[model samples]
Target: ASRCAKVRSSDVAVLELERPGSNARHRISEEIARAISEDKAEAIVLGCAGMADLAHSLSEEHGVPVLDGVVCAVTLAESLFKVGLKTSKIGGYAAPRGKRFAGMFAPLSPAG
Candidate 1:
């Protein structure tokens, strides 16, 4: 939440839930309800990739858009692909210029 506050102006709320527990749907629904009523949240974004499956049903129940990060990422990637957008090879996504690989990774070292 603190990190988010530094980057974004909107309020950030963290709701922790058990990763493999059976009651996630219930707890998430309760949190969504609370966020809407208390925080005036217009939409909810699922924090965990594992929660992707619950977004649709939760949105239906809460009457708001519930977004899954994984889905959003894939959709953005697909849209970029469709529009022939490619990552710039001269910048951050560029091939390493002088990176070295040692031991079992020697074959991965860039060639001269």
Candidate 2:
């Protein structure tokens, strides 16, 4: 809230997710609607990748912009790439420090 307030002033209301998995779309939508009603928020910001596909539909159903982080990221990256804007190789851009894995996560090791 403080970080965003530095650039733009707004009310930040944190909504919690009670359920999990892709099957929680309707429940999530209900929660979003509830939040909007309670907070009088102008838009819905989806916090999960699984909610990407529901963005447009939810936006239309709720009469407001429903933004999904995954979709926004992909769209922004594609737009940037099209305009020849590449990511800067500084600070957080460094290559991942690989590590070993065990048990059921062994297949996800860097060696693989």
Candidate 3:
């Protein structure tokens, strides 16, 4: 509860599910219904990747937008690729300088 409280704000309410799993569809729906009626949440975002399959049905059931992180991530990646936007390779994600690859990975070594 403390963690949820720490992340909660006036605009965002973080509600935890009692039973978090793909099989807990009924529980998840009930929790989302509570958030809608009580907290007045306009959209629902599933917290677990395992819940991705339920987003569409839940949205239809609750008459609100439901988002899955996996789908959102893939969609975002597609949009970024279409726009020619890519992750910068100069900072934390930069390949190691002067690194040598041997064995089956020899061809993957970055050019100096």
For lDDT, the strongest prediction is 1
Alpha-carbon shift of residue 21 in model 1 (angstroms): 8.6
Question: What tens digits encode model 2's per-residue C-alpha lDDT throughout 1-112?
Answer: 6322122212222232334443355666676677677766777777666556778988998898889998889999999989999777777997677888999999888864
| Error in Å for residue 74 of model 1 | 0.6
lDDT of 1 by residue, 12-76 (tens): 22333334445657877888888788777777877777677889999999999989999999999
TM-score of 1: 0.62
Clashes of each: 0, 0, 0
Q: Per-residue lDDT for 1-111 in model 3, tens only? A: 432212212221233333445336776788888878776777877877766777999999999998898899999999999999988998899976787788898899775
lDDT (CA) per prediction: 0.74, 0.68, 0.73
> TM-scores of the models, in the given order?
0.62, 0.54, 0.59
Cα lDDT for residue 9, candidate 2: 16
Who is ahead in TM-score, 1 or 2? 1
RMSD (Cα, Å) of candidate 2?
11.0
lDDT of candidate 1 at residue 20, scale 0 to 100: 47
lDDT of predicted model 3: 0.73
Candidate 3, residue 80: how far the Cα is off, in Å: 0.5
- lDDT comparison, 1 vs 2, better candidate: 1
Model 3 lowest lDDT segment of ten? 3-12
